[model samples]
Target: MLDNLPLLLNGFSLAVSPYNIMLMMVGVFLGILVGVLPGLGAPNGVTLLMPLTFGMNPVSAIILLTSMYWGALYGGSTTSILFNIPGEPSSVATTFDGHPMAKAGRATEALTTAFVASGFGALFGVVVVTILSSWATRFALRFSPVEYFSVFMLAFGSFVAFGGGSPIKALVSLGLGFSWASIGMDTVSGSMRLTYGFNELSRGINLLVVVIGLYGIAELCQTMQASPGTVQPVATRLSPREVLRAVLAMPRYWIALLRSACIGVWMGITPGGPTAATFMSYGVGRRFSKAGARFGTGEPQGLVSSETADQAAGSAAMLPMLALGLPSSATAAVLLGGLMIWGLTPGPALFAERPDFVWGLIASMYVSNAVCVIMALTTVPLFAAVLRAPFNITGPLIVIVCLVGAWTVGSNRTDIAMVLAFGAVGYFMSRLDYPVAPLVLAMVLGDRTEDAFRQSMILAKGSIWIFWSNPLAGTIITVALLCFALPGFTALWRLARRQFLPPPVASGR
Candidate 1:
């Protein structure tokens, strides 16, 4: 680590140059906009801007793109907090506690905690990239189909067990999501499964459309039904004292912050990416925190866990893309393409040939994290002001934004209609006390999980024991099984004890 100081300094010098700094700032601002608004996400934002980087130096182009990535991660929380809508799939975890905090008139606190935690997580990811790139890349490559499948199962099992709802209901929601995900053409055989003879259905439902309809339009419908007349505003201003206090409180949750960062980094290096990291961290944090029982009900710990992991994974994803020529997430894949377009080869070879480029990208991440935090904090008043407006006025704006977001994907009108349908489904699910998180999460992981399981089975020549053939895969599978079984075991134990225990004496009566 000590031997890399001069290279680090050179990287920092390049990142801090006037042109690069300005580019970083612009990227952050646009990224935040894209993140807060519906439809456009980090991948879309980066791809839209990729053409503009054609004539620029690779270092400058990457700094701008990566900064935008960080900014979008930060910006996603804004909409999740202010409204029930999550601008990105990862931000869905943020909505578990963030919007409730907003409704409780603690929007300022929620936003502050999310932004600060995101900065810490992103900075940690960047530092880890600089110091452990080689080792981490190698470690990530060790995850095979069985291990990946076990991990995905663990994620689903965790939600079913500790999602603070009826386990049966969670399972039902999970199954529903999987069913919805199966609507597209089959990847293995190229045969359509549930398209129902419609050409649009053959293409399958887009997750972004589902998210926008379920959260945005469905939320508006609920608001309209709940408060038929005048819509009131919540408090949105934060005092300087409050700001300092929130900043000071950061140390109290350092353990959660650090744990979330680690989880994020792991997911970022592997195939799970930021969305999975946020959900997994949030679920684990809920089970571990003493305030676990209050998760999804305006708990600050949930916000911290979700936002921290979300940003951390976003940053860590760059490591595998740059060091291994592997894209860990959708956004990273777009960046990977950009890297190729610039006549630069990714992987270990890039490091040997262009040390300055690699290190410069690493150093610039540090600067971007700082810049994003500052920009988000300073703009708190502006976002909070949106919460000040009456729901009637802001409601339509959100709907319009949701429509715009839906229109951006393939310019398909069918998607807009699907959004409305899912909005209705979401509203009914809420009314029925079903956990939407599981549904959304399962939808996100369904295709990947199925593919992994099938691939594992094929590799094992149809043997079911392949999941347990390797020690690593076996251990993870065992843990995942235990997570699901613990609840049932406890219930049975209580029933047996009740049956064996003697009746109470008359004195008890």
Candidate 2:
């Protein structure tokens, strides 16, 4: 790590150039706009900018794309906090407490906490990448199909065990998500399994469309149902002072911050992705925090956990993309393609050959993230003001935004209808006390998990022992099993105490 210091310093010098700094600002602003709008997430935003980068230098192009990515991440939390909509899939967990906090008239604090925590997580991830680039490349190479499957299972198990809801309900949600994920043609068989003769279903449901309906449209439905007429604005005070206070209070949750950053880094390096990292971190934080019981009720720790994990995973993902030619997240995948388009190859050789480019990108991460925090902070008042708008106006605007966003996903009208249908499902699910997090998690990762499992099985020739044949895979599977059984074990322990141990005696005196 120390040997790379001079290179890192050189990278910083390159990143801080006036031209690169201007690109960072432009990328961040555009990214924030994309993130604030539902469905136009980081992946889409990066893809949209690819064509424009052809004329730019590789370093400049990457700086623009990565800076935009960081901005979008911060921007996504904006809508999640002020409204119940998640601008990005990863921001879903942020909505759990962020929206509630906004409803309680603490929008400024929620936004501040989210942006700051995200910045911290991103910096932490960059530090990890700086220190562990070579080590991470070697570690990532050891993962086989079996290990990948184990990792996915661990994510699901964490949700079931640590998610503060009925395990049965979480399972049911997971089942639905997996079922939805399986709708498209099977890759191996090339057979349509769930289309039911509908040509539109052949393409499969777009996850973004589903998310728009489930969170954006669903929230709209709930809002309209709860209040028929114009609803009064939520009382909120947005100021630099409030933001400062939130920043100052962050140290109190250092435990959550560190734990979530670790989870994010692990998930990023291991293919769990930013979306999964956010949900898993939220679940783990809920289970471990002193105020665990209050997680969903406007808890700052929940926001911190989810946001921190999200940025951490996103940043750490760059390591694998740069070192191993593996993109852990969709945005990273797009960026990887951009690298190829620029006539650069990924892997260990690229690092040695293009130390300036590699280290410059790393240094840009630090500079851009710091810039993003400041830029996002300055925009809080503007975003928070949206909450002060009467529901009569904002309600229609939100619905329009949801429909528009859904329509853009595939340029198919079918997605708009799907969003509406999912909206109804989301509304009813919320009324029924079902957790949406598991469903989203399943949908995002379900297809990949299935593919890994199938590949593992094929390699094993139908034997189940492949998962245990290696120490790493075996340990991961074992941990997953423990997570899966934790809730049941807790229930049994409580039951045993009720049956054998005496209740607290009434102390009359």
Q: Which candidate is the best by TM-score?
A: 2
What is each predicted model's overall lDDT from 0 to 1?
A: 0.79, 0.83
Tens-digit lDDT track of model 2 for 1-509 = 68778888999998889999999999998788768754356765675566578688999999999999999999899878876767787999999999999898888899899999999999999999998875655665677879878877886787787666787787898899899989988877899979999999999887767767776677566667774543333444578788889999999999999999999999888756798899999999999989778999999999999999999999999997887565666577668767876899777777778988899999999999999999988876665564445667766766776677666656898988998899889888877878776777677667768988999999999999999999999998999889889989999999999889877985577
- Single out the weakest 10-residue window by summed lDDT for candidate 1: 227-236
Error of 1 at 32 (Å): 6.4
Pairs clashing within candidate 1: none
Residue 506 shift from truth in candidate 2, angstroms: 12
lDDT, candidate 1, 1-509, per-residue tens: 56566778889998899999999899998788767655456765675566667678999999998888888888788878876767677899999999898899887788889999999899888887877865644554677778778877876776666665677788898898888888888888799999888999998877667766666677567667875544333465677677678788888989889999999998876646788899999989999988778989998889999999998898888886776555655567667767876899776667768878888999899998899998877776675454445666766866777777677655899988888898899888867878676666566567767988999999999998999998988988888788778678878898897779864653554
Model 2 TM-score is 0.68
